[model samples]
Target: MEVICLEDAAFYTLIETVVERIKEKLSTTEDKWIGGEEAMRKLRITSKTTLQKLRDEGKIRFSQPEKKIILYDVDSINEYLEEHAKERF
Candidate 1:
């Protein structure tokens, strides 16, 4: 085995760099809106009608900034899945 050491300042800098990278990764993954196709893929569904149904029924959250453009909330989709998840014995 080889030994390596970092000084106090260097060690703190390294830790800060790692924390910043983690924050970047988390912010990217926590995207607030996704297009219909991506939302469907994440929910493992193939029907636009079904997706619309869920949106219409208020089972999921979505936004329509324009008449024809829609974006689903990622957090709402995740919550929906967790709420409907089946329990195991």
Candidate 2:
């Protein structure tokens, strides 16, 4: 077995590529994503309530009884934030 680390830029590029592929697959469907607390914090730039609200409103995506998690579709969050980011800016 081999261990792959994300300390290198190449690894990030690979992650990006994979995320793009996943995004393409998800684009054709109306799917909800489950993001980690940190990523959600970064996306919303706020506390848990707002994030939960976004999830509740179906404006973003997630599940309840939240905990520290990382099973997110990064591409979906990126797209959602990019589309709605200016509201914060």
Candidate 3:
């Protein structure tokens, strides 16, 4: 019984570690980019003005085409998360 529990715990830990690694890889993929609505959802913010503010502040890494549409890089998003994650309100 104890041995079974230990094996289960090890399996859970290994799974968690693999999941974390995959998440990191996905987050850092240079070609990975999400559109506006999904990006906003991930960031947990809905302010159009706030998005603009980030652009103006150069806090977000994005590409512009035509006149108005903005596309954000996944790695940049990850970097932003890492930078802002240290603070909590």
Candidate 4:
């Protein structure tokens, strides 16, 4: 195999470019998902059952990326809250 090397300045520039590209990609979000704990915390609830009920009733959407893991869409949770917001005088 042939060996390739970059000088100090060139290496730093390459690293900076890679980091910027990664940041840009990360900043562009399609959908954000949160775990049960975070969702409950956001909604100020202490029961996972409540979240499960929402999922069961199809009030919100969830994803099971793994066999035993679940994630809820942040936008759906926020939308649910907005839809159910109470009227204040």
Give the alpha-carbon lDDT of every model.
Answer: 0.95, 0.65, 0.76, 0.89
lDDT tens readout by residue for model 1, 13-82: 9999999999998877556999999999989999999999999999999999999999999999999999
Worst 10 residues of 2 by lDDT: 63-72
Clashing pairs in 2: none
| TM-score of predicted structure 4 | 0.63
The candidate that wins on lDDT is 1
* Candidate 3 residue spans exceeding 4 A from truth: 1-31, 87-89
lDDT of 1 at 71: 99
Clashing pairs in 1: none
RMSD values, in order shown? 2.6, 12.7, 7.4, 8.6
lDDT of 4 at 3: 89
Q: Candidate 2 lDDT, tens digit per residue, 27-62?
A: 886334545566566585667776666656766555
Lowest-scoring 10 consecutive residues by lDDT in candidate 4? 29-38
Question: TM-score for every candidate vs. truth?
Answer: 0.71, 0.40, 0.56, 0.63
Residue pairs clashing in model 3 are none
Alpha carbon lDDT of residue 43, candidate 2? 85
Show model 1 residue runs off by greater than 4 Å.
1-27
lDDT winner between 2 and 4, please give it.
4
Instruction: Tell me the lDDT of model 1 at 80.
Output: 94
